[model samples]
Target: MIISFVQTKGGTGKSTLALSTAFSNHMNSAFGSVALVELDPQGTLRNWWNERTELGRDTGRVSFHHISSSQKEVFADGIKAIATHNDLIVMDIPGESTGKLHTRFACAVSDLVIIPMRTSTNDEAAFADNLYPIIKEILKVDPGKKGCFYVLPSFTHPKANRDTIMGYFTDILPPHVGCLRTIYPDRSVYENFNREGATLADYAYSVRENKRHSKQALSAAGDVEEIARAITQMLEKEHVSAKKEEATLRG
Candidate 1:
């Protein structure tokens, strides 16, 4: 399965979602191997992988590859190559400056394209104006592409703002665009884990830090696990649906 993490605006935690999804898959052993393709110009995913290596963490289940925006063909080839060896391939896409061709290409090959958005007026407007159009165009080109598109509400606060954003999405997205039930709240522990070059689970038994870090690590793990469960259910439903469709056609 090829999953692309994308959004129209920056600071929406797209790369973080990509990393968390990859980590979750690795922990569950749901995939034989997972490859994280960093298509973002900032190379945030690549940097995160390097940091994990520097920290001497277990990076065996996930491999990170950097792909330049100029190399569209190479990107396509890389996706195909990774799919051969890995059961899951997660692509981190640039948020602000993605061109038409690049967006279409990623959407074309992805089994799922996830757009992470924060609860904000600007984010809602951008999603409606920029991201929705691109998604529509991609579907137009390949209507039968067996891919699921989702708009994940990220960095959600337990406030009215979150509800407002949820209402907006419910109004706009079609029935096929799955709504991710897991809302990732904004927390400092996530940033700390990113800087430490490890996931929340990795720091659970750390000897260096005190009790606070360990507690925070456990909390973050809980949140990530919830999101991961939602994602897994979505993918499993797709798989089951596809098999049923095949059987129906055969009958």
Candidate 2:
């Protein structure tokens, strides 16, 4: 399965979410070989992975790949090559600053396209102007992609009500774009967790002495796990639906 975290607008915490999701315990347990692929030319994740290598940290079940190619053919071929060996390919797609080339490509190829967005009016407007149009275009070309796109509420207040947040997105999102059941809450730990290529698990272990920090890390880790679990559940549902469709056609 291929899952992509994509946003046309930057600074939505999509990269961090992508990395944590790849490292999430749920993802590792569900997928045998997980490959985290970065399509950003800016190389945000490349730096982090380099640090991990310098620190002599092992990736274990998860491996990292950086594909900075702008050509769709090259990008698609690279992802396809990775997907052959890996059970899951989680992509961190770059924000479409110059153009929506990467965004469009990622959306079209991914089994699940996760858009990390905020509840702000500016983000809503940006999506309406930029990302939503791409989604609509894709759906027009292939209606089967109706269930492939989802919006994830990012940087939400930890104390915020889940139902209210999900409801807000549900009302605004278009027909084909669904809202995820889980939210990525804003936490101080997230800001500092990735320092020196450290994963959330590493950060939690490092801050074990501080009760408050440890608790926050635990909560953030839980959020990533929930998001990963939700993605896996959605994939399972889509798989079943596809099988039934095949059976019906055969009948």
Q: Which structure among the candidates has the greatest TM-score? A: 2
lDDT of 1 by residue, 1-251 (tens): 88788776777887887888778743357777888788877788788788888878888688888888576788888778778888888888887666655566677788777778765678778877877787777778766554478778877763336567667677766655656766777777777677667766676666237777777677667777777677767778777887888899899
* Candidate 2: C-alpha lDDT: 0.91
- The number of the candidate with the highest lDDT is 2
Looking at model 2, residue 199 earns an lDDT score of 97
Q: After superposing candidate 1, which stretches have Cα over 4 Å from the reference? A: 25-27, 98-101, 158-168, 207-209, 249-251
lDDT of each residue in 166-243, candidate 2, tens digit only: 989988888889988999999988898999999999999999999999999999999999999999988887788878
Show model 2 residue runs off by greater than 4 Å.
Answer: none
lDDT of 1: 0.74
